[model samples]
Structure formats: C-alpha cells, structure tokens
Target: MRALSVYRDTTGSKLVLDDVPEPDLADGDLLVEALALGVCGTDREIVARGPIWGTERPDRLILGHESLGRVLEAPNGAEISPGDLVVGIVRRPDPVPCGYCAVGQFDLCENGQYTERGILGRDGFGSERFRLEQDYAVRVDPALGLAGVLLEPASVVAKAWEQLDHVVRRTRRRALVLGAGPIGLLAALLGVQRGLEVHVVDQVEHGAKPRQTRDLGAVYHSFMEDLSGTFDAVVECSGVLVGEAIARTAPGGAACLVGIGAPHGAGTVNLGELNLDLVTQNKLVMGTINSNRSHFEAAHQALRQIDRRWLEGLLTDRLPLSAWRSAFDTSPERIKAVIEFDA
Candidate 1:
C-alpha cells in the first residue's frame, strides 16, 4: 500500500509518497479501501508545524483524517457490510475513560490522552487502505460519491450547531459565519437548512465562495464594513474574526469559535467593558473542536438533505494519490481538494 507520510525534521515540507504495508484488520474491524480524502486547513497546519499532537516520530505517521472509503471486509454480524461507503471518526477515547469519554463523548475527553487518527497519536487515512472498529465508521450516502469526503468536516459544523440550538431561544434566527472556507461554508449551509438568515464573511470577495454563498441564498461579505446588522448567533470559522465577531454578537446571542489560529503576539483587551457586556447582555461565547459518533450520523443526515450538485461544487480538485504533492499546494481559488485513491 502506498501512503502519504510527512517528515518531522523538515517542518513545512511536502508529503513523501511511499510504499507502506497494508493495514492489518482484526476480525471485527472494518477493512476500508480509501476512495476519496478531503484536505483542510488542519492538514496544512500539521504539514507546516510538524506533527505536534500525533506521533513524535513525525515522518512515520500517515497524514489524512477526512476520508471516504468502501468497506472491503465486515464481520458477518456487523452492521456495516462490504461495498458500504463510510468515513472514519478521527478521535478515540483516552485510556483514563474520563467522564465524557465514559459516556461515549470522547470528543470532550478530559485527560487529553485521546488519539486522533492522522492528527494525534494514531496513523491517519492517507493511504490506499486503513482499518477501524465498526463502531467508529459512519456510513455515507452512496449518492454523495466523492462528495462524501466532506462528511467529517461537516460533522464538526453539525455538532457546533447542535450545541448552539440548545442555548439560543430565538425562533427566527440570524447567523454570521466568519470564514468562507469549508467549515464556514458548511456552517452556513447548516444554518440555511435550519431556516436562519445566514451571512458569510471572508477575505475573498469575488470567487467561488461568494458565488456559493449566493447559491445557498445566503449573503456574503468580504469586509466587516459591508456587514450590516449584528447576528443572533455567530459562528466564527476563521480565527481572525474572533474579536470582531465577539464584539458584534447580538445581545443575548451566542458566539461559537471553531477556528484554530496561530499565536502571533499579544494584544491588549478591554476586559472591563467585555465583562460588563457579559454581565448585562447575557451573551454566551463557547469554543467547539471535534465531533462525536452521533454528530457523524447527524452529518450524514445533513449531507443527504443537501443538493448533491452544491456539495460536488465544493470539491475543487481531485488529484490522484501519485500527484499527492499538488493536493497540499495552496491555491487562492481552491475550495476543497481531495486525494482520490480508486476513482
């Protein structure tokens, strides 16, 4: 099996396409043949900073977490079967089985011992094949085809919106998503599905993002100056807008931070006034990371409801595994890039 491995010594280096042994699957485990894999900002960051969370031996770990595959082998009694399309959940519970992990909410693992496939201690799915426990594999709609690779990222947005639904009380809500990347666009898609008046703000003013936003019947803004009203719920997918998004969150509204930004330098904050708003406006600000199994299922449902043509449009590139280098290359017009294994 050929897999994409990143070198630890050379941070910000390209992935090395090498021949690796095929995954060994247990009887109850699923043997998934990779079909398509989505590459996101986290993938780019790991390639740039070296493997900070996954393996200490940087180059040894595989480098993909968002994936779509077909089951090659499934135990007779298992719910999954051969030929089923699926996406593997990245994180596994820690050994300590913290309260959240004990309840199958490993996404909130407390001990910080969780192993995230491709990103943390475990090897990723940047290969021709990988094996996972049946419980960790979420089935994808066959109709999605290559589009199913978006499911993992979609799960994160689904989980974030699921959490927000609990805190927000407004019937007719308005949402502003801070970035027009995959996460932000998906968040906006979910918002539209929920009947919210959605607005997306990103640096790119006249590209696929703005067109996609309009196609979804949502407004898109490149600068905050063009942004009109405060939103009842703000989902910050780009870390750059945290301050402004937090500032513009409507009174009694909730803001969710989903982007993981780099540390540049320190800046002063008006904690006194921010605290005053927190005290009087009943504002809520929360940060969400990964998603759990249920969220994956929710993501599956969300994908099913969306127009396949729109989901297909988000996949801007589909390079084969041999052309892996081009998969990681950053492009201004690229929306989503995928490494296709078989198709």
Candidate 2:
C-alpha cells in the first residue's frame, strides 16, 4: 500500500508518499479502498508543526482524514457492502467514556480525551487502502462520485447549522459566513437552503471563492468594512475573524465559530466590553468542531440537494497520488483540493 506520511521529528517537509504494508483487518472490520482525500488547512498545519497531536504512532503518521472510499470487504449484515461509497467518521470515544461519549456524542466528549483519526491518536485513511469498523463508516451517495471526499468538512458545517437552528427562533433570518473556504462556503449554502439570506466574507475578491458565493444565490463581500446591516446569525469559519464576526451580530443573533486557527500574536480583546455586549444584546456565540454519524448523514443528504454541477465546481484541483508534494500548496483560486487515489 502506498500512503502519504509525515515524520515524527521536527523538519518542515510537506509529506512523503511511502510504500507501506497493508493493514490487517479484524473479522468485523470493513476494508475500504481510498478514492479521494480532501486536504485542508489542518493538514498543512500538521506538516508545519510536526510531532503534534497526530504523532501518537511510533514512526511516521498517516496524513489524511477527510476521505472518500469504496468498501472492498464488509462483515455479514453490515449496513454497507462491497462497492458502496463511504466516509469514515473521524473521532473515537475515550477509554473512560464521558457523558456525551456514552450516548455516541464523542464529538462533545466532556473530558477532551477523544481520539481523532488522522489528526490525533489513530492511524488515518491516507493510503491506497485502510480498515474501519463498519459502525464508524457512513455510506455516501454514489452519485457524489469524487466529490464525496468533502463530506467530512461538510458534516462540520451541517452540525453548526443544526446548532444554530436550536438557538435562534426567528424566521426569515439573515446569515453572515466569514471565510469563503470549504467550510464557510458550505455553511452559506446550508443557510440558503434553510431560506436565509446568506452573505459570505472572504479576503479573495475576484476568484472562484467569490464567484461560488454568488453562484449559491448569496451576497459576497471581500472586506468587512463594506458589510451593511446586521445578521441574525453569523458563522465564523475564518478563525482570525472571531472577534470581528461576533461584534457584527444582531442583538438576538447566534454566532458559530467553526474554524480552528490560533489568534494573531500580540493583541488583547476588551473582555469587559465584549461580555457586556453579549449579555445585553441577548447574543449567543459558540464554537463547533467535529461531527457525529448523524451529522454525516445529514451532510450526505444536504450535499445531494445542492446542484451537482455547483458541487463539482468547488473541487478546483485534483492531483494524482504521485503529485503529493504539490497538493499541499495553498492557492487563491482553490476552494477545495484533493488527491485522487482511484482515478
């Protein structure tokens, strides 16, 4: 099996595609062949900061989590079968399960001891082949084709919108999505599907990001300064704009922070004033990360409702496994980039 891996030591290399042994599967486990793998900001961060959460393995660590695969082997009575398209959920419950983990909400593990595949303690699905327990694998619509790799990231936004649905009680709302990356754009797409007027903010003015935002029947803005009026809901997918996004929320709005990035160095927020605004305005600002199986199921259905051509347009770059080095480079026009294994 050929897999892309990063070394355990601290050298800033992108990734190394190595020929490794195929993993042995358990009797009840399902074998899946990699079809497509989505590479995101977190993958780049792991390469830049080696030996982080993903270095739990002894030697090199597998380097993909957002993946799409086809089942090759399934235990008897497994919900999925051979040739079915699937995506493996990322997180696993801790040894001593938390309250949330006990109920299959490992995404909300109270003790923060959960293991995330490809990102934390477990080996990821970055190779030509991998094994997953059937329970953790969710079937994706076969019609999605190569675009199915996006289900993991889309699941995150789907969970965010589900949370926002519970928080806000108003109708005909307006939503502001910060950062026009995969997560942000998907968040906007979901908001539009929910009948809200969606507005997307990103630094890129004239590229595919802005164009796709408009394609979804949403407004696009390159800068926050030009944004008019307030939004009933705000989703902060650009971690750098958390403070700014929250400040722009309406009096009764809800803000969901979905992106994971460190704060820009050397600045302090006015905690006192910010607290006052949140309390006095009846606002809700929350952070959401991983998703559960149900969220993945929801994302699968949601992705199907979207225009297939538009969904395909989000996939701007596709590289073969041999061109692994170039896959990690960030580009202005790229909404989503993937490495195609079964192409």
Candidate 3:
C-alpha cells in the first residue's frame, strides 16, 4: 500500500509517498480502507517543520489526522460492519493514564503523555489502508458520503460549542466567528443551527468563505471593526484576533479560542482595560483543542442535520493521491482540500 510519510531529524525534513506494507489489525481493531483525507494547516505545518511530539525517526509517521474511511474488516460483534463509512478518532490515552484519560477524556490529558494520530506518537490514516481500534472509530452517516471528511474538524468545533454552553447561562442571540477558514465556517454553521444570528469576519471580502457564510444566512464582514454591537457568543478562530474577539463580547458573554497562531513575537495588550472588562462584565474566555469520542459523535449528528449541498460547498478542492502535492496548496481561494484515495 502507498502512504504519505514524513522524515525529519537535525539535518532537515522531507515528505515522501512510499510503498509501505499493509497495517496489521489487533484485537478490537477494524481494518479501514482510506476513502478520503482532509488537509489542513496542521498537516502543512508538519510537512514544513517535521514532527514535534512524534517518533525519534518520524519517517514512518503518516501525515493525516482528519480522515474518512470505509470498513474493510471488523472484529466480531463490532458496532460497525464492512462498508460502513467511518472516521478514526485522533487522540489516544497515554500509558500512565491521567485522571481525565482514565475516563476516556484523552482530549484533556493533563500529563501531556497522550498520543495523537499523525501529530504525536502514532501512525495516521494517510495511507491507502489503515487499522483503527474499533473503540476509536465512529460511524458516519451513509448519507453524508464525501462530506464525512469534515467530521474530524467539526468535532473540534462541537467541543468548543459544548464548552461554551457550560459557561454562558443566558440565552445566546448573536455570535461572532473570527475567521472564515474551514473551522470558522463550520463554527458559523453550528451557530446558525443553534438559531443564533451569526456574523463571520475574514480578511477576504469575496470568494468561497464570504459566499459560504452568506449561504448559511449569516452576515459576513471583511473587518471586525465593521461589525457593530457586541455579540453574546464569540468564537476566535483567527489566532491574530484573540484580543479583539474578547473585547467585542457582550457583557456576561463568552469567547472561545480554537486557532493556533504562529509565534511571530507577542503583541501589546492593555491588561488594565481587558481585566476591567472581564471583571466588571463577568465575561469568560476559554481555549479548546482536541475532541473526545462524544464530540465526534455529536459532529456526525450535526453534519447529518445540515444541508448536504452546503456541506459540499465547504470542500473546495479534491485531488487524487498521485496529485497529493496540489492538495496541500495554501491558496487563498481554497477552503477545505481533500485527498481522494478512491479517485
């Protein structure tokens, strides 16, 4: 089977599509045929900077975390059978098993020993075939088809919303999503689904991002300053606008930061005013990263309820594995790019 592998060391790093042996299935593991793999900033970063928390010789580290696959084989009595569309959960609990990981909340692993597929210490589903632990594979709605590729990213958004729900007791009427990338667009979609008036701000005034935001019946803006009035819920998906997003949240509202920005040196922030606003208004700001199994399941349900056409619009490019290099293009017009294994 052919797989995308990343090799990195003090010398340098490189990405190669090598012919690797098929993965062996362990007890409680499901053999999955890669259907499609989603490409995001994380994948691009790994290819550029090599592995961070990965193996000493990450040459074997397949570079995909967002995956969509079809079951080729399943262990006895597995909840999913052959031909069922599924996505593999990315994070696994550490050997020591932190208190959170012990309860299946590896997304919140406190000991920093958790292994993330394609990111930390494990191989991922970037190959033509991969083995996924049955417990970590969540079945996708057959109706979603190719849109199932969006599930992993959607899971992160689902977890963020879940966290926001726990903090904000009052009704959330309006939301501001600070970025129009896949994550930002999905965040807007969920906000719209929740009946909140959603507004998305991105640098681009035209193109798929703006159109998609409008398609969801949410307002789109080129600049955050153009959005008048504070929102009851704010999601900062653009790492550059954390301060601005929090500053625009209404009294008693909450802001969730999900984007990981480049470390281009710190910017100035007025602690006195920011602290006063938070203390006087009783506002909250939280950061969320990976998601648990429950979030993936919730993401599936969310996708099932969404308009299929709208979901499809989020996928701007689809390329075959042979053209995988093009799939990683960071073009402005590109939304969600996918590597179609079946193509």
lDDT, candidate 1, 14-96, per-residue tens: 56889888886641289999998888888888787767644355447788999999999888888999999999999999877
lDDT of 2 at 92: 92
Tens digit of lDDT per residue, candidate 2, span 1-343? Answer: 8998877654444468888888767412899999999999988888887635443456677888999998998878878889999999999999899999999999999998888778787778899999988879999888888878889999999999999999988774799999999999989989999999999998888978988999999999999997998899999998888888778899988999898777562135798988999999999999999999989999998999988888888888888988877788897667888999966
Candidate maximizing lDDT: 3
Q: Candidate 2 at 124: error in angstroms?
A: 0.6
Model 2 TM-score (2 dp):
0.96
lDDT of each model, Cα atoms only? 0.86, 0.86, 0.89
| Candidate 1 similarity to native, TM-score | 0.95
Rank list by TM-score: 3, 2, 1
Candidate 3: worst 10 consecutive residues by lDDT? Answer: 51-60
Show pairs that collide, candidate 2.
Answer: none
Error of 3 at 47 (Å): 0.9
RMSD of each: 1.9, 1.8, 1.5
In terms of TM-score, which candidate is strongest?
3
Tell me the tens digit of each residue's lDDT in model 3 across 193-279: 899999999998789998999999999999867899999999998788888888899999999999988874225678898899999
lDDT comparison, 1 vs 2, better candidate: 2
